[model samples]
Target: MNLKILTLDEFSRIDFINLVNKVFEDYTVPIKWDVVSFQLDVKENSISLSDSFVFLKDNIPFGFIVVSIRKEKARIDAMGVIKEERGTGAASYILEHTVNYLKWRGIRKIQLEVVKDDIRAYKFYEKHGFREKRLLYSMILKKTINQEINYRYFPVEPRTAYIQALEIYFNGRKPNWQREPISLLLSDNRYNFTKIVTNSGEGYLVWGKLEKENVPIIDIVAKNNYTDILKASINFLKSQTNCKNILISSVPEDDYLYQPLKKVSFQSILTQSEMEKEIF
Candidate 1:
C-alpha cells in the first residue's frame, strides 16, 4: 500500500472540490460543495491551501484535511477520509503530516470541532493529542415568535457592530473559529447587522441566510439585556425573511447568548465538542 500526501495547492480547484465532496459524502452531516460555496469558504475562513493537505493512496485522493490559519492559531475546518479508505491509516497520516507542517510554520495552537456523538472521530482526535475544550451547541427556533416586539431595531454597519461586540460582549469570551472577530471581518459583507438600543443597554445582531428556510444568527453580542435584544432581533428577522427556522450554530456553552437563546425558545438540535492542541 503506497500512500502519499500533497498540499491542496498542488491539486486543481475542480479536483479538490470533487475530492472533498467524495470524502465527506458519508460524513456525520454529509457535505456537498460547489465552486461558489467552496470559494466563499476559502475566503471567509482564511483556508490556507499551502498548508491544507490531501492524502492519496496509489495516486487516488481519498482523504483530506482543510486547515484555516489566523496568525499563530489554526483550526481544522474540515477533515475526512472516504469510506473506502477508512481504517487504512490514511486519515492519521494526513493529520500527522498537517500537524507537523503547522508546527513548523510557527503555529501556536490548533483547534477543531467534532460531533459530540461521533465517538470514532472524537477518539481519533484524542489519540492524536487533541483534547476537548468545550461543548458547542447548534440551537434552533422553529416556531415563530408570537410575542409583540416593542423595541426598534436599527440597521448598522458591520464594523460598528464588531467594534462594540469586541469591547463589551466578546471581550473575555471564547468564541469558536467561525464566530471569531477575524472571521466576522472576513465575511462582513455577507451578513447584515442590526442594533437595538434599550433603556438598560444596547445589543447587536449579525445574521444572514444560508438557505431559503434557514436564517443563521452568526453572532449576537450585547452589553446588557440579552432577552429583549434577542426577541427584537428574532421579530425583525421574521418580518424580513420567509425563513421557517432561525438557527445559531456552534454557540459555546459558556457564551452569554446560550442561555438567552434557550429563554427565547431556541432548542439545541446538535452538540459538538470544541477540541484543541497546543503545538510547541
Candidate 2:
C-alpha cells in the first residue's frame, strides 16, 4: 500500500472531523468530536494545521496525529490510527515522521497525556522515548444544589495579569500544555471568575463551561481555608448558569486544591499519566 502524509489544512473541515471520529471510533474514552470543539481546541492551544499530521494509504486517511507547537515546546494533542490500519506500522511511521518534523523545527520538548488505565498507549509512548512524569486526576462534581448552600461571591472578569498572579501558586495545578494559564488565556471563550471573602481572608475560583459538554470546568486558587470558597463558587454556578455538572480536569500530583475540591464533593472520575520527551 502506498503511504502519504498531509496536514489538516489539506482537508476540508468536515472531512477532517469525519476522519478523526472514524479513527477514534473504538477509543477507550468515548469522545464526541464536532466542529465547535475542534475549533475551540485549536484556538485555545495555538494549534496550527501545518504541524498536525494526517496519514493516508492509497489516498484514504487511515491515521492522524495533532501537534500544538509553542516557542520551544510542542504538545501531542491527539493521535490515532484507523482500526484496519493498526498493526501495519502506520502509527509508528506517523509518529517517527512527526517527531522528526518537530525536532527540525527546533522544538525543545514534547508532551502529552494518556489515560492512566490505557496500558497499550502507555507502553507505546514508553517505547517511543516518552517518559512518565506525573499522575493527574479528573474530578467531577455532579450538580446537587443544597438549599442551605450560600452564594455570596461576585464575578470578576479576569485580565491576563490577574490570572497569572492567581496561578503563581496553583500554576502547575493542571496539565501543562492544555489547561495551564497560557492555554486558558489564549482561549477565545469567556471565563467566569468568582471572589469570596471569609474570616480567614480572600479566595477565588476560575471556571467556564465546556463548549461541547456544557459542564463547568473549574480551577481554584485561594487562602488556606479553601473549602468554603469552593462551596460558594459552586453555589454561584448553580445560581447563575444552567450547568448540571462541574469538571476539574488533570489535577497534578500534590495539587493543593485537590483535597479542598474533594471536601466540596468533587469525586475523581478518571486518572491520566503525563508524559514528556526532551528533544535536542
Q: Best by lDDT, which number?
A: 1
Clashes of 1: 0
Please provide, for model 2 over 27-129, each residue's C-alpha lDDT reduced to its tens digit, 9 standing for 90 to 100.
Answer: 8765557998888888877887999988888988888888998899888988988888788787888888999999999999999899989998899889999
lDDT of 2 at 240: 67
Between which residue pairs do clashes occur in model 1? none
- Where model 2 places Cα greater than 4 Å from the true spot, the runs are 143-151, 160-175, 210-214, 242-244
Kindly provide the TM-score of model 1 when superposed on the true structure, using C-alpha atoms.
0.94
What TM-scores do the predictions have? 0.94, 0.86
lDDT of 2: 0.76
Q: For model 1, what is the C-alpha lDDT against the true structure?
A: 0.85
